[model samples]
Target: MAGGNFMGRVVSYVVNELLVNTLANSPAFQRFAVRTSKRIEDASNLAARKRQELQEQLNDSLRKFEDMSQKKH
Candidate 1:
């Protein structure tokens, strides 16, 4: 049983090494990684802007409500 477990680990290690080397050596993979990273950054920025806009709108609405309430009293 111990021997079988050792052999399984050895196979897994070799496969992992091969995959790592292939990805490191491939230009296409490098470009894909860069593009994906850029897209994630862009999406993050867009979300932040949208969040700010929503917060501003909410603040404006609250101010208007407070002004109307004060005028009534």
Candidate 2:
């Protein structure tokens, strides 16, 4: 019974080591992290583009209004 217990312990340790090593080398985990980072970058870029477009539109309208006012004056 003691020898059987010792063998079980050894098997458990080996399995644990294998799991840790496999996880550390996991390509899927790395890809997931990379994809998450790219998504964040794309989202930020999209927000910036929207903001710039809105600002340009606002500027154009303001300029047109200013020109119309000046003409009336």
Per-residue lDDT of candidate 1, residues 1-73 (tens digit)? 9999999999999999999999999999999999999999999999999999999999999999999999999
Write the residue-wise lDDT of candidate 2 on 22-48 in tens digits: 877999977987999999999999999
lDDT of 1: 1.00
lDDT of each: 1.00, 0.96
Cα RMSD (Å) between model 1 and the true structure? 1.3
TM-score of each: 0.87, 0.60
Per lDDT, the best of the predicted structures is 1
